[model samples]
Target: MWIHKSRNPNQNFKRGGCMFSIFLWEEKDVQRGLFKMTCFSAVEPKQLGVILKDMQRIKDGYAWFLDGCVFCIQPFQNQSRYSLKGYRIFFNTSIETGMYLYDITLGLLGGQISGIECVIKCPSKKSSDWISGLRSDTSFQMTDPRGLFNKNGCGIIVVNDTVILQMRNRNKLKVYEALKKIDSIREELLSSVEYDLFSCSKEAG
Candidate 1:
């Protein structure tokens, strides 16, 4: 059961319908009294090392994760007659101590390439960042091949506690399919997410 933790709605990005997120519990306790909640921001690859260095609450606010098989969606606000909502996909508890790993190239890869130089770039620009995060996490795994997250990858990170984050990835096919699969029973998960968000905002005030 993931919850919303947004305060001061104005700081959020535009609600232009292209926004999404998947975050975690990010709370700020002030003098052990009033707690403030501010969403976390993205850390560039150069800054990813710093994020991992801090063992602070990660579920606080993570953008997304993309590799090959493992992927996550970010949460965002809605703009229809004043509305705020987000989504989440709960993973089974079978996930082990380590994370998942995968490889996603642009065009057809790992096959005979007629044009050697003109072949597809190993990692596409769009999904390169998030996927890079997954690759980095795998690097810290306590298993074989410490730095073998490069192509033709393996191990799908399929489990984690419900995390709340802002949707950043624009892969329509992946986003639509993932959302549909998880919220099938509820049909529209955002509707419920919106209600939760509204409640959280009131509580914050």
Candidate 2:
């Protein structure tokens, strides 16, 4: 079962309602601690490569992926949230190795987008940095944003661990072609990924 991670209550922020997320996880074994979560809208492929080099935890398998389109929604008007329409694919990896590869691909795609929001490996509970980041950005919402995986009706949860993330019911085949390309070079690019998760607090502190 996936668990939802909650954000600090003290922080304050204001943002629009448009939101969506695409996450890939090993549905067979949640306890193995191997999964990849990502968000997107429109991103430049080239700039993304530069950002990946800076994130060490993702390189080391200690952080989950987070990305989004910073301008998708506006605070003043109630706009319909964006959806990954027309694509349908169950997010089941053939094996644990597929999970690792998908996670890496998700992380890489994250940087291609405008907002590479935040990265928190599962089981992480709290972080002052995350709290401060929420308060610092007026674009980010304090509550859950509407759309897929946001069944709770709240805006994006900064710290998410619950089954809400497992996305057992929904998947996108639009990424299938991308996943195939990623898988082709997977062996040469990702030989072995450590499934261990590092505490967000320990590193944030």
Best by TM-score: 2
lDDT of 1 by residue, 96-167 (tens): 201121011111111111110000111112233333433555332323232112221212211111111212
TM-scores vs. true structure, each candidate: 0.17, 0.21
Q: How many residue pairs clash in each candidate?
A: 23, 15
**Deviating ranges (above 4 Å) for candidate 2:** 1-125, 144-156, 160-173, 176-205
lDDT of 1 at 11: 31
Report the C-alpha lDDT of model 2 over 1-205, residue by residue, as the tens digit.
1122332212222112222222223222232222232344233323334543433221112122232101111111222346321211122233343334434644334322111121122233233333443455454345433212122221234333322222222233233333343333232212211211234345777
